[model samples]
Target: MKHREYGVVQRVDHHGRTAIVNWYRTYTSTDEPVPQLLYESEMSVYDLKDHPDFQYRPGTVVIRVANFTGEDANCTAGQ
Candidate 1:
């Protein structure tokens, strides 16, 4: 992957700094926890490397977080 700058602060905040993106993740499971105060910062960023159409991007390797069967996951895991 190529190098690019990213932010640690949420996009909707009044103040923001482009901090090193330590990592990226997505959780479709209802078991995951999200505090009430954290609802604003979940904005998306665009990445031309993956999406040529310039869709709303979260800057993460896209994992099919929903509706993928277990066998599909195992196959990708082997790659």
Candidate 2:
């Protein structure tokens, strides 16, 4: 997984859990791709496709997906 990348969901956990996610078709957005933190994890890999907000792992290729914007780049804790 690269930092601040845009790509499609390559795989998902069969156990219905968030495991290691891989992105193949990747792209880089000149503008920051914003994601609604509240709804970030709300959608699954299947839901990401055709979704206005292309959600995925940290820093995955999101392309033109419409998402929320925040000043905080690091969504993780203790950053």
Candidate 3:
């Protein structure tokens, strides 16, 4: 599976076991289009915060989506 690496977490939704993560997608290639999505996953805020690749800080926008786990391919967030 292939996953694009460009996004920022706009918000975190915790209504159930899965979280609806609002994110702003980014593109590396100029030809690529930017995608804004609300990805739903089982990952928690603490999980993201503890991620080695993801530097989760207050007001810290995600500029890249690190493809560490292949599970990321199953995650999708969009209007």
Leading candidate by TM-score: 3
Over 1-79, each residue of candidate 2 has an lDDT whose tens digit, in order, gives: 2343434444558677443334332334636553212112223545443324454556666343333347544344434
Each prediction's TM-score against the native? Answer: 0.20, 0.21, 0.30
Best-to-worst order by TM-score is 3, 2, 1
Query: lDDT tens string, model 3, 4-41?
Result: 44234445666643344444444565454455453533
Who is ahead in lDDT, 1 or 2?
A: 2
Q: Which ten residues in a row have the lowest lDDT in candidate 3?
A: 1-10
Compare candidates 1 and 3 on TM-score and give the better one.
3
TM-score of candidate 3 to 2 decimals: 0.30
**How much lDDT does each candidate structure score?**
0.36, 0.42, 0.47
In angstroms, the error of model 2 at 69 is 36
* Cα shift from native, residue 62, model 2 (Å): 20
| Candidate 1 deviant stretches above 4 angstroms | 1-19, 34-79
